[model samples]
Each structure stands twice: as C-alpha cells, then as structure tokens.
Target: MSAPENREAFVRPPALELRGVTKRFGAGASAGRGARALDGVDLVLGEREFLVVLGPTGAGKTTLLRTIAGLETPDAGSVALHGRDARALAPADRDVALVFQNFSLYPSATVRENLAFPLAAPARRLSRAEIDERVAWAAKLLHVERLLDRPAKKLSGGEMQRVAIGRAIVRRPKLFLMDEPLTNLDAKLREELRVELRELARELETPVVWVTHDQAEALTMADRVALLVDGRIVQTGTPEDVYARPNSPLAARELGTPPMNLFDVERKDERWITADGVELARADAGAPERATIGVRPEHVLLDGGPSDAVVHVVEDWGPSRVLFAHVGAHALHVLAPRDCALRAGDRFRPTFDVRRVVVWPRA
Candidate 1:
C-alpha cells in the first residue's frame, strides 16, 4: 500500500478508553490488605492506533489487559468503547478479540477449526461459507495457511502462535488485545512475527492494545508506548519520545538494550563528577544539584591519552564492542565501534555525548 493510503486506512475512532480504572483483589481485611492490581489507570487508544504496554513483572500489565478484555471487572472506574460503557459488557458482547500469551487454542482441534471457533459464536451468526472465508483470510494474513489441517497440539510454538492470532483476526472485532502473543516463540521467530503482526494490524485498520515486556518489540511495533510501573502508567508517548526523552529514571532504564547506565554525580563547584569519576561539564548537566545521572552506553566515547580511566573488560558484539572501564567505585560501559583498538586493561579516556545524558533528582 502507498504510504498515504496505508496511513488513511489505519485511521480509526477511539476504540478503547480506561478512565480512573482501578482493580483490587480480595477484601480490605485480607492478608495483603486489598492488593490493588491497577491504581487509577487512565488510557485512551485512538482508532487504528497500536498501543504497546510495557512493564516489568508484577507491574500489573496482565491484570490491566484482562480488565479490558472483560475477563476481570475493575473494582472501581470505567471502561468505554465507542463512548459506551464497556465494563458491564460480556467478553463476547464487547466485540473485542484477545490473543493470549498462552496460545489458548483447543488442543485437539485443527488450525482451521480453531480459526473458525470465533465465528461460530451464537451472537456472530455467520454463515458457514462466511466463516470459511474469514478463516482463510486470517490464515493468509498470518502466513499460516499451510498449517490449516494440523491439530493445534502438533503445531510448533511459532505455528500455534500464528493460529491463535488467526483465530482472533477471524472475529474482526472492534478492538484487538494481545498479551505477549510472540513470547512463546524463539527469538528469530518472534522477530519475524513482530513485523508480520504490525503489517496485519495496519492492514485491518483496527485499534490494538498489545502487552509485552520486550522493549525492542515495543520500539519496533508500537506507534505509541505506555510504560507501566507498579500498576500505574508512569509515562506514555511515541517510541521515539520515550526513548530519547524519558520522563523518569525508571522509564529511561527500561528502554535500552544494556539499559541506561545510572550513576551518582557529585557536584564539585563548577563541574560534576560521575560515580565513575568522569568529570562532566556543568552546562551540559541536568539536575546538577542532584546526585543521580544516566547516560546510554552508546553515548559514551572511548579515546586514548588523558582520560578518566582504563578499560578493564571488552565484550565484542559484532557491530560494536562494550568496554567496561573502571574509573572509581563503578564501571561505566562504553559502546565502541567494532574496529576500536581497545583491549582489557587498555588505558582509555571516556567522553560523553553531552546532549544525551539524563539527570534525575537524587532520592
């Protein structure tokens, strides 16, 4: 599809809304004292927008998704779809399709049968021919048409995942919710399917809310990302916004491959000393009065001559090398170009991209 046509096709109305949504488990008298899975979570998904929710484990990511799918009702707050109250709606009545992490397919059923199951719902009332057509279309979209006759139990993890996605797509629901749908597959297959799913979601022009802990997947597939922490969304923005300008230390740390290097900075008159003893310019430092500083590995540069310290370890990672150097009480990782002539115990000076450093208030 042409870029303009593709963008236009994906235009959609607000398909999902969560306002002051809070989900609590057990009574106030319980041992945990009413564990709140969600705490006043507020979110909105525009038509055809792909929103990926990311968080660490125990962050209530799953609970938030379950609530939206109508499998779990929020103890407080409301869910709306197309301006209608959705909290009172049943899972089927919500016209939402969920592709779960566990690949919740009937083990004994063939791929074709599993894909047809959603269409067979009494409320759908689809004709047999229509169901077949939908199943065929979804299978083609997911590139699983060849596995149609195989029983779900016999399919590989990747194939089963495709089947699960196909089943959800056959319903053509107003909203699509995926809970780490590619987590079960191998890394290579997961990467492959990530692109496929993005294309499929774009083609269908449906709003999607996907939950995943994989930062790379979030960066690659999501038009916008919601960073959830402790059952609350800490930040929400486009992948570029969140990655380049994270509002919190936690959000910045969560977006990188090796994660952002966090250090305590001590202000010494006009300059700041990172925990690793690298002197930082005051003009380039944010929160200069604070003690914490964060910089991504890629922003660090390795040079010879007058430097902070020497490289203690070098890990070659094909395109680049991660140089772990000792400056003081901490190790600062520097992402060096592959040809960088640095070895363990090599004397190296470190330079930082001043514009890329992030400073956080000391706690």
Candidate 2:
C-alpha cells in the first residue's frame, strides 16, 4: 500500500479570515445615534482565491475593504491575516495593498517614482538594483513600460490606472484589495484590463478581494462571489451557481438587469392559480404550499398556445429584442429574437421550460 496520507500536512490556513466583523460610525444624539457601516460580517479568503464582493450602492463594500486594510477599526470581531491577528497593525504593517477607484497617484511624481515609492521606504531598505528590478517588472506587467518617464498628471485615465496597479505590484503584498479600479475607464478599456487582472491573479498566486457593483465584472472575474446587502453577506458561491439558482427573492431582484420576474401563486388542488385566476400547470410534488415562481426575461418564450398578455413595447437591439408586456395587472419583460413579429398592442403568451423556473417559498 502507498504511504498513509497526512491530512494535517495538506491543510492550508485561509489567507484572510473575518469573524463577526462589525463597525459603526458616530454615537449618541449628536451623530444621529449611530450608523452601522458593517454588521456581523464574516468571511474567509482561501489561499490563492480571487473573491469578488458584489453589491449595490451604499452596501458597505468599501467599508469591508477598509476594515481589512487596517484603515478602519472594527467595533467588534477579529481579522486574521495569514493566521495572525491584524487589528492592531497599522496600514503599512498589515502587508496589504489597496487599489482605489480614483487612481491615487501623486500628481507631482513621475510614473517611475510612484511605482518605486513602496520599495523606497526605509523599512524595506532594498538595494538600488532590487528596487529597479521590481519597478521594471511591474511596468512590463501593466504595459506601462513606455510611460515610466512620463509625469503621472500628464497620463490619461487608463494610463494612470495602470500605474496605480503597478504601484501595488511592486509592494508584493499577501492580500490584494481592489475597490472598483476599473470604474473610471471607458467600456473598452475596462474589458481589456479585466482580462489582464484575471491573468495577473493566477500568476501571482496571491489572494484577492475585489469590490464592485457591476454584475458583468463580477461574473467574469470572480472565482467566487460574496453578495452583500445592507452591510451583510446574504450569499456566497461560484458565479454560475448563484446565477442559475438564487436562494431568496432579494437575490433574484439583484442579479439581473430587468431582474427575475416573480409571480405569487396559490395552490389549488393539483394546479397553481395566478392572482388573476389564470390556471397554470401544477408545480412538482414536495414544493412549498405557497411560493413565488421566478423566470428570467431571456427564458420567456412567445411561441405558445394562449395569449395571456399584450405587448406594451418592443426594444430593438439589432441582434435581439426585448418585449415589455402586461400580463393581468403585472408587467413582464421578455427577451425575443430579432425576427419576432409582435408589436405594440399585440396579444402574446409567455412560456418557458419547467426546469428553468426557480421557486421561492413564501411561507
């Protein structure tokens, strides 16, 4: 027989771990009692994991990163970085790098100086050759080798953003925290950098926690996504898993553009009855007695037997079309092909595969 495996030997500790992390701002009557920036937030970043924190505006995504970077102290909870308590450490002592949305480059410095600043500090005390080597490596990695001599203030938004990333790369931190780094760039530049960032994450072998409100960005770049709502983590899973199966109504509302249409239904004998008394096929046995039926816009099909609603509007996109329809009192959105002949005031029926439907229990 082969040698017995050592489970302990194979076990690797998390790169970053948070337990019951809570942070509040202000107190008493002067500051409106108090406001909680983060409440009982707990998360763990596995070794070499690229975790994206996704949420809407005012979801405390930035606060979470500030807490981990030691910029904001938690009112309660512990932050363990590489198995060491990091709460008492200063921002620099934490050995973490943060890339902000607005590229925080020094206006007076050249691209080379900004990239060299982290290594030039007295604590690091690196030799001239070592610092030069690191600076050159970062410049090449970010495709900013030609801009090294250019003043930071003179560079375009995209160029400055790359330099900001280069600054972090030279530090070589254990954890990388990016707060909407691509938000300021144009659409094309955002897409280009997104691919580069994903590749860099793999080559560096460092844990990264990226914060963004863009669904497309999260779906494309994340190995796993942590969905936050009102300062709390509502769900965490792979992009494919969360998109295909949302656990709650709140999740369905947040994931898509038009979002998942939820229809409240009542079970009547073996059939399900809509609010307007339209009877549909019965849900499978063992489903909740009272639940909401959810289906995506793209899944709604128009070629069916009955006309349940009238098309209110049609949005043409060359390749496909989006139909806005009124079904009883509820408004529904359907994604249709460019060949769709339905127009305004046209009656149509919406249908979809049973397996594609997501059921959310009401009771």
Candidate 3:
C-alpha cells in the first residue's frame, strides 16, 4: 500500500472534539457580563479513549462536562461528535450518558426499575425484552444484580452508586461523561470502583471523558490527562507523559499526589540556586537565568548531606513516609521508605534528584 492509502485507512474521525469552547454563568449588573466558566477550551477524544479532565475545585471541570453532555450551552465555539456538529442536538438526541457525583436514582424505586428508566424513554423504542436484557447486562457488569430487587434508598452508598452507573451503561451510549462519580464513596470503595469502571469502559469499547479534581483517579485511569486551570486547558498528554514532562508549573501541580515542590531560583555556576544561595539542582543547559525549579517529593532524598533540614512532620502513607521539613528558609516535602524512623524535630540533610528536576520560566 502507498503512504496515502495507509493514511486514509486509519483516518477515522475522533469520537469527540471541542474547538474554542467557552461558557459563562451569572450575568452581573450588565446583561452580558458574567464570569467565564470555560475559556476557549479545545480537546479531542479518540475512539474508545479514556480522557480525564483533571483540575481543582471551581476550575470548570463540571461545566466542561455539562457542556459536552448538552446540559449547558457554550457561549462560543463548537462541539462535534464523530465528525458531525452537535449544535442542533438536544440532550437526549446526543446519545451521551452523563453520570454525576451524586447518585441519581428514585429512592422509592427498586434498583431494577432505576436501571430500566433510561430504556423506557419513548425515543428509545426498545421492546420490553430488550429493556430487560439491557438492564440485566448492566447490573451484571456493574456487579449490582444482587441488589436489583431492593429499593434504591435501602442500598448502601456504594451500592446506590453502582446502580446509578448501571442506569447509564444500560443505554450503551456512544459517549460517557462521568463527573467525579466516585468522589463521595469511601477511599477503599473508590479505589475498587475506579479499577472496575476503567475495565468496564475498555470492555465496552466506549469513549469516556471523566472529570475529577483528584490526581489519583486521573493518573490511574486516564489514557490521557487534560490539565485545566482558571477555565483554560493548560496541557493535555498521556498520564506518563504529563507526569514526566509537564509543559508548565500548573500542569505539574495538577497531576502529582502531594504536588510538586516549586520555588523561584537563579542560575549560576551551572546550577539553580535559591534566594539564599542554596543550590537546588543542576541547571538545564538552556535554562533561563531566573526560573522556577519543580522537584517531586520522591526526588527530594534524605541523603545525610550538608543541606541541614529540620523535620516538621512525618506522615506515614502505608507504602512510604512523607517528611515535611524546612531546609534553610525553604520548607520542602520529601519521600522516604516506610521503614525510616525519622521523627519531628529530627535534623537531616536533603538532596534533590537533579536529573529529574523540571524547570519553567519565572512567573
């Protein structure tokens, strides 16, 4: 085959695309004046891709999802699905499933009824047998079949969430928009559901846009992560790529656990030194004279060097210990093995993993 033929063969359109999408809310004193919830956001979702929209609270993650689901109108730009413009499409016509953070179900209704409600829509035109089959399939897939006969209000929080998810999956929509569906669950349950939902999406071969402020969910579940801040998409890349090479300091902060350690520094003697002449790390060959260097907690090592760090606190995180300490006048967080016996007030030396440092121009 020729190059052109190869290219044409794999040129299928993306599952979803947003071009300069912007949305605003709350008209102030002026009729058209309002706060920007989304500012010229652009993104693309490949067929069967799981893209996580990672951001902080009030960063417009929910607004983005709502706009995509047709529940909110964008003030500008276009939304497209599978190469077709969705401007004229209503919420139901879009054939997209949106699962919210709160478990949405009729408390008085049985789990089976809740799961079957979506199928009962007149537009679906699904036969009774087909509806039953779909509900059964979704319940089995989500492992909520045992609770099918119980009322939604009688189920545990985890169970109700499962049924709510079942309601969405029963439709088998072309796209899935999940808005932090597991945020309300307990930690262990959230972890369990995260893996389950990821596998389910893969098995169904569905494209999903999952929104979350939690970096753990984004890093563990996303095929790609879009870092949103201040109503704009700062960067988008695979989880590994974003974590390893964040385009900016904000992107670095969006995907880390305790977040990256960022501080302004000056370049001198081929190194980045802090304000007090404490060398932070080796300078990149093309690093600017003044820039910010970001070091991950794990990259800050307690090497017993001459850095003079006083431990402010030690947090045991099961697999590792996090040491919050002050090195000189700058406070830092360091990661150590769980077996380390460092206590508060203990003095130690901290070293930066120079090879892993990330630098950005000073802002």
Alpha-carbon RMSD to native, per candidate: 4.2, 2.4, 2.2
In order, the Cα lDDT scores of the candidates are 0.84, 0.86, 0.89
lDDT of 2 by residue, 191-280 (tens): 999999999989999899999999988899999988888888888899987787878877777787667777887767655567677654
Positional deviation of residue 128's Cα in model 3 after best superposition, in angstroms? 1.2
Task: For residues 111-203, write the lDDT of model 3, one tens digit per residue.
Answer: 999999999999989999999999999999998888999999999989988888888889999999999999989999999999999999999
Kindly give the stretch of ten consecutive residues in candidate 3 with the minimal lDDT sum: 24-33
Task: List TM-score per model, in order.
Answer: 0.89, 0.93, 0.93
Model 1 score (lDDT): 0.84
Clashing pairs in 3: none
Pitting candidate 1 against candidate 2, the one with the higher lDDT is 2
Q: How many steric overlaps are in each model, in order?
A: 1, 0, 0
User: What's the candidate order when arranged by decreasing lDDT?
Assistant: 3, 2, 1
Task: Give the Å shift of residue 81 in candidate 1.
Answer: 1.6
CA lDDT, candidate 1, residue 223: 94
- Top candidate, metric lDDT: 3
lDDT of 1 by residue, 57-156 (tens): 8889889989998999887889999778997788879988998887579999999999999899888789999999999998988888999998899998
